[model samples]
Target: MSETLSGQATSTISAVVGRADVLIVGGGLSGAMLAAQLLRLPGRRRILIVEPRAELGRGEAYSATELGHTLNGNAARMSVDPDNADDLTQWLEAFIAKGGWPESDQQHVPVSELFPPRGIFGLYVQQRLAEAREQGAVSGSTAEHVCGEAVDLHIDSSGARLTLADGQCLEGAYAVLATGMFPAARTRQKHSSGLNAAAIDPWDVAAMSRLDPQGTVLIIGSGLTMVDAVVSLEQAGHRGPIRVFSRHGLLPHVRRQPPAWEDFLAADQSIRSPRQLLREVRRQCAAALASGIDWQAPLDTVRAHIGRLWSQASDVQRRQFVRHVRPWWESHHHRSPPLSAELVERLYKEGRLTIEAASLKGLDEPRDGRVSISIRPRGESRARTVTGEALINSTGIEYDWRRVDRPLPQQLLARGLIRPGPLALGIAADPGGAVVDAEGDVSTRLFAMGPPLRGMWWESTAVTDVASQAKALAVRLAQLMDSQKGRG
Candidate 1:
């Protein structure tokens, strides 16, 4: 059964959704944006979007219903249009004028700076996709959302084929792996750490409400997801102690509007090594601070250059960066929203929340009806036990394709259709988003975008990244389709 956040999908009741010119494996934001881009282009191709959810746009990130669960970045930075940065700002203004998001006024910020709730953002994506559909209708192009989870994929000379969880089968001239990020709290990994099974989902606010309000809550990881878990706990009326554990215990910095800084990386082409880049960034940040500018201004300029630097870096350099710099990079780069940061700060000030630098060693039997775990401190060899009324795993996104225990990933790996990306971050793919097989051969019929290309582009999961990729990949697919037609 295909279920949406609101209800079940109403129209799809078939085991076979038929053939199309293009088959998108996942129908989240990546798939929806890709479909939207394709629909707007001049074409007469039939497209099939295979997804389990009834809704077309609300992926894992934007499906939150809580008011407290908001986007980390403001509207200005989260637009889905690659060419038009103000697309979301304009849409939000019109949406507000239509009497939507009545509570948005409480944010007391400009439309561009407002951190809209994820649910509202999902609606905006759906509306944009609706417009794309209307435009596509004028042409002979069309797309359908097949509400089913894709289990396995097969590629042959004729076409690419997909098998759904509910026994549905689909075919297309070519397929794209728009499979989005897999969050660690909810996904199944090959290595059974037993931590996820012992903990509650970080986003499930309803489950949090059942816990004792005054009991201590133990959390793992201190990144943006940990911030979200705190918001969930607070909204669920939990007021007791909150203890967070991670290797670095680095809390994300609060995102703020900063003045534009010079693009140091762009101007200085020699900044390729991680050490050199870090030193230059420090110098730039120091200069910014001395000039009374926000330090994040310098850091923001580095965002555009990550793909170039990462892709060109040697594997040894990449390892050095990951080993020594990853923690600080994540904490500074993936910042939390101001409101969420304020809540976390207030709780810390009140002595209600604490952070510890440690790593999970093992899970133990429940003690005194409380969840228990063993953790070793950063510089210590002794393992210590920590217990809580409830536990949450907020370790953030899992990018290692081999660790993901899903059927599709496993099948793809076994069939040599895909390979682990650089440093095993995500599946390896070529520059144009074509899937690179186990034998290092580029796939002609299968392509990838969004998080699946993390190895190729270090920052592939962001909104702007996905939008740019969607537009480019859509054009590539269209050209491929035209060539195939000519051959036929």
Candidate 2:
């Protein structure tokens, strides 16, 4: 169910079929992690997870049916346990021994370096949640899966009341806005560019298969998503030219298992501004290359300090970073898996994939069973029309809450319950994921995590980051509940 927030207290509990101590608005990895953390705590708080999907833990990111769609991070770096870094590696090793993933041997890499399929990752998440559920059951802390969409939310001094699409209401002492990222291709838009209506989904290999096998494909945006589309095309037997367009036509750097370099950022305490950070990074890269080390080693070490650095930087510095460094930052930081990168490179070398430094102007009406789009090449004065047999909008995830054409985000903004994050990246929230309203007041009963905390924690979407946040947030919630118990 989808819900928009209302400021006034129409908080009626009538017809409420469900009541929980914690109401988790999303059942994706973030919600599942929160539930697991809450269950682990020494308390008996009831948790109700509201999600429309039939299965939990598999959000938009992991709901891939294609094995070609693999997680960007390898197992070692993607562990959900903060203290136990090799948790996923240990689980995967046992699972592979039991003939779970027969294709595991093809990677030929150590279990820690093998990037699992997104679907399999979702399965791993579900298994962890199940284990947590059993522990919770023994502790008398219950977790229920409410299979429905939330449409309306009302908050009062006592608690929050949520209304679902089926007219059923659910109440809870606290609510979490754990809704995940909204991919541009799948999400509806308030003001659209007609790209989504004409473009095919990035993961839909079946739809790509129906297209002319030898016809050209037009792809907008060149990032990890673009890499996925290229892989999808090859898997669907597409042999025609693939034209990729973006403002800055930079492909993601291939992820590598590079030897560890010294943690330069940790050793330096003066790196606060984006400029200083970039300069230091360049120096570290030069030093690493001079020492015959991969540049990625130094950059990878900076991942741990990103939230601290980004949050501490002034707004001017942030804008400067966005204007001057965002393109390079994204391309360098969000790297592609080796196999997918190899395919993209092979197709490009084979004269089948052409990348253009251009910006999409708009869409032209389809003519002769082909998709037409207007694009102005970089540094060009005029826009030209290009047509292809198929078009895929691989732009990436939509981060701005105000621009998200969803019922909940729209209502949240309308009601001033949440404000846009710095530079409108995502919704604004305090350090602990307490939502900040338009009037600059932090929310106590309402909190958020995961991708919704993009602005609060720049790298909050990563598996490790989400796990740490869940642990901290769960501890905070337990403290709040304990205080309430003391008062009662």
Best by TM-score: 1
* TM-scores of the models, in the order given: 0.96, 0.96
lDDT of 1 at 229: 95
lDDT agreement of model 1 with the native: 0.90
Residue 423 CA error for candidate 2 (Å)? 0.7
Please, what are the lDDT tens digits per residue for candidate 2 over residues 327-420? 9989999999888999999998999999999999999999998899999999999999999999999898889988888877887788788899
- Candidate 1 C-alpha lDDT tens digits along 1-488: 12121124223433335578999988889999999999999978778888887788889988889878999899999999999999999999999999999999987889999999999999999999989988998897787887778889999988898877866577888999998998889987767577788889998889999999999999999998899999999999999999999998789999999999999898999889999999999999999999999999999999999999999999999999899888989999999999999999999999999999999988899998999999999999999999999999999888998889899998999999999999998899888899999999999999999998887878899888999999999999999988988898
| Candidate 2 Cα lDDT to native | 0.87
Off by over 4 Å in 2: 1-17
lDDT of each: 0.90, 0.87
RMSD of each: 2.5, 3.8
Give the worst 10-residue stretch by lDDT in candidate 2: 1-10
